[model samples]
Target: MAASLAAKVHYLDITGEIDVFEHASSLDGEARQANILLCPGVGFDVIPTDCLALALKQALPDATSLCLGFESHSLKSPGTAKTTVEGIGQGTKIRREATIRTEPMGVRARRIDFGQGERLAVAFPWGDVSTAYKTTGIPSITVYVAVTSSFRLAMLAANLLAPILRLPLVRRRMLASAGTAVGPDTEARREAPTYLWGEVRNESGEVRTARIRTANGYDVTIHGALAVLRHIMEMRDFDPGFTTPALLCGASLIEELPGSGKIKIR
Candidate 1:
C-alpha cells in the first residue's frame, strides 16, 4: 500500500553503453518504517557502479541517513544473484569493465527514524539491501529486492524460519539456495510465450542474449526475455495491456518460442 504519489528521480554515476532515464519509485517495505526507492525496469540502468554512492548521497539530506558503510550487497541481479549474505567481505580492487548492475549487487541503507517526513537520499551505495531497518511514520526506506530465484528462495526460507531464525536460540537461519532451474517443465505449459532470462556466456566470453519468440518475427534475445518478463510481471500490479507502466514487451506478437532458437516457456 502507498500513501503518496511523486515521480522521484535517480542519478547514476558510471560509464555504460547509454544513459537510461526510465524509472519508478516505490515505498516498498513492511512494519515499522515506510521505505522508498526508485525502481527501474529490467534491461534498464540500475545505479551505476562508479558514482552510485555519491549520486545517492546527493539524493538524501543529513537527517535521513541511519547507518552508512561500505558493503558488498546483491540486489541488482535477479535469479540466483539475490542470495548474497551481508558481511565485511573484501572485493579485489580491479578495474571493472562491467557495471554493478551486471552482477547481483546491493546498496545498504543506514537505519534512521523518520516521522512522516518526506526526504530524498543520495549516497555511494554498497547496493543490495536487506529488510532489517523498520521505522514508523514518514515514507522511510529499508530495502528492496528484485524478483529472482535466489532472492525468492532466500525470502521464502526466511519467512518460514521467522523470529526463531533471528533468535540466537536457533541461530542457523541461512537459506539454502537451489542451484539452477536447469530443466524445462513442459507440463507446466503457459497459454502465452514465457520468458527465460540471464546472461549467456557462450563461445565468446562476452555476455550475449537469445530471446526466441516474436509473432511478428522480431529479434528475441536474452534482453528480450527480460523485457517480456518485466512486462508480464508489471501487468500483475498494473495492467500492461491497459494501464500505466504500459506493457511494451510486445506480448501480443509472442505466442511460443521460435523453432530455430531455444526459447523455454516454463
Candidate 2:
C-alpha cells in the first residue's frame, strides 16, 4: 500500500512567483518562523471552511494565523475557477484571478513552502491524499469523508479506480469525456445526509479512524476540522506522515459531537 501511494507522489516546482493570493501581507519575522497556516482545498461543500476558520480563531489563537484557498481549473473548462485566499491580518484578501500553471500535476498547484511550521491542511474535498502527504512534511494529517451507504460504496469504487485512473490510455479517454454531464437524478448522484468518516495516517501507516454523525446538519468535515484543531492544540507528537484524527485525539473527539450524533471509533 505504501509503495502504491509513493508511486503517485509527483514533485513539481513553481517558477516565477505568480501572485496566487490577492491580498497576502508580507509575513513578519515572528509569524514566518512559528505560526501555522491552514491551506484548505477548493470546492466549499467538500470542506467545512467557515467552521474551520471559526474554530481556529477560537481555539489556537496564537499559532493559527492564515487560511489559504486555491482556484481549480477543470480539464474541460476554458476559464479558471476564481478563488479567494483570506488572511487573518488586516482581513488580507489574496485572490487568484487566473489559473496558475504547474507541470506534472496538470492543473493542481504544486507543494508550496510557507517557511517554518507550515502544514498542508487536508480534508474531504481534497481527494489526493498521497500527494498531500508527500508535499507537506507535517507528520500528522486528517482526512474526512462523508460516509453514507452510497458514499462508502463510492469510496470502494474510488479505491479500485485509483490505479486504473493512472493508466495512460484510460486517463486520456476519461479526460476526453471530462465535460460530459451525467443525469442529476441518477443513482450515482443520489443525495443523503452523511456522517463524517475521519482517518489519520502518515505515509502508508494508518493511525486511527472515527465515524461521526450530527443532527444539526454539520457534516463530518467540521468535526474533521475540530479533530485537527484539537490535535494541534494538545501538542501531541506522532510519526511524521499522513495520519487519522482518532490517532491524534483518540475517542474523545467522537464523544464530543453535539446531540445524538452517532459516534464510533477504531
Candidate 3:
C-alpha cells in the first residue's frame, strides 16, 4: 500500500557506528526546535565521575549538543512507537546502542527564517530502535534518515556532511571506533546557556556544550546526544555515498509506531 500509495511515514536507516556531531543554532518563534534534559529516570551503577555527556566529547570530536529527536513508525501504522533519540548506529559517544523508537510524522523542524510560520526547512528522520544497557542503566541511541525531496532537513544535513564525508580518511577515523569506545575522561564542567528557538528546552537541567568537527562544516553549541544522532541519520538518508548504511545491509527492524522502541533495563 505504501509503495503504491503515498506512505505517511518514511523510514531512513543508517550504518557503521555513526559518530555523534553537533551544530550551533538560533531559534525563531515557531520554526520548530527541541529541548532535551538528562533522563532523571535513568541511572547507572558504575557512577563514574564523568557522565555520558562527558564521554561524548572525547568520542564524537565534531558534535554539538542539540535536543531534537526523530520519530520512526511504519506508514501502515502510525499509532505506536516513538522515542527521544540522539543519533544513529552504535553511537558510543552518547552511550546508546539501540535505545529509542521512532514517530510517524516528521518533526516540526526549524524554519529557514524564524517568524513567518513557514514549514520545516529541515526534515529530521525517525529513530528506528533502542539499545538497552545492563550494568550501566538504560543507555541507548536512535537513528533517522531524510531521503525524499519532501524532507528539507535531510537536504541540509547532506550539505553539512559533504565536506566531512568527502574525504575517506575522516570517515575511517571516526568509524574506526565502532563498538569499543569507553568514553571521554572527566573534565571541568562548562556553564553555557542553551540558545534555542521554538519549544526547545534542556531537559537535563545542566546545560553543556562542545565544539565538533565533521566531514562537513561544524558548529559548537549546547545540544547533546539527540541532536548528534539526528545529524548522522539525516546525512546517510540523503547522501549518495552512504545511501544504505552498513547496519541495514543485513537485517532490518520491523515496521512499527513511534515510541515502541525500548531497552529493557533488566
lDDT of each: 0.24, 0.30, 0.23
Candidate 3, residue 132: how far the Cα is off, in Å: 9.9
User: Model 2: runs farther than 4 Å from truth?
Assistant: 1-51, 60-141, 182-266
Ranking by TM-score: 2, 3, 1
What would the per-residue lDDT of candidate 1 be over residues 118-180, giving only the tens digit for each residue?
Answer: 122212222221110111111222222123345444444554545555554343233222233
TM-score of 3: 0.22
Ranked by TM-score, the better of candidates 1 and 3 is: 3
Alpha-carbon deviation at 263 in model 1, angstroms: 15
Better of 2 and 3 by lDDT: 2
Clashes of 3: 47
Best of the two (1, 2) by lDDT? 2
Give, for candidate 3, the lowest lDDT window spanning 10 residues: 40-49
**What is the C-alpha lDDT profile of model 3 across 31-146, one tens digit per residue?**
12122111111101001111222233233333323222222111211111111111322121222332333332334334322222233333333211211121112233322222
lDDT of 1: 0.24
**Per-model RMSD to reference:** 20.9, 17.3, 21.4
Q: Which ten residues in a row are the worst by lDDT in model 1?
A: 129-138
